[model samples]
Target: MANKYKCINEFVVDSYDENEQVEENDFFIVEVGSIWELQDESYLSDVRLMDNEGRWLEIAQSHLVEDFVKLN
Candidate 1:
């Protein structure tokens, strides 16, 4: 079973290139899941978000702070 969530805040995410470099054109808003993988370090760990497309993203804890929530 997967968790569910929604975007409470708007932020931009950048993608990486073949050389592991950040691409400016890859910048996008996080329309991913509100449901996330729980972390032991809530404030110091990166949260995992599963998008509507079944893609998973590991974002910094700061990025998701007060921006995402876990569904029952």
Candidate 2:
């Protein structure tokens, strides 16, 4: 199993499409849900984060800028 992460800040996801002229990546917010960081053995790269909206983003861990909170 892998560790899960929740987006604390708004970030951009570069989602490619058939259109060659699109210059912007998709924007994601905290409400979108948590992102998951899978282990190295997984077929996907170790740095990829899985978004709650089902979008897989390949981003550096440092760029994520995440924080964890304790729950009661």
TM-score of each: 0.53, 0.48
- Looking at model 1, residue 36 earns an lDDT score of 45
The C-alpha lDDT values of all candidates are 0.57, 0.48
Clashes of each: 4, 0
Q: Write the per-residue lDDT of candidate 2 for residues 1-72, one digit (tens) a residue.
A: 457666555555556344422337554443334555543542322365554456555555555545321122
lDDT of 1 by residue, 1-72 (tens): 455556777667666454545677776566544444443332213665656545445577676667776566
Backbone clashes in candidate 1 total 4
Checking candidate 1 for backbone clashes, the offending pairs are 4-35, 5-34, 5-35, 6-34
Give the lowest summed-lDDT range of ten residues in model 2.
63-72
Highest lDDT model number: 1
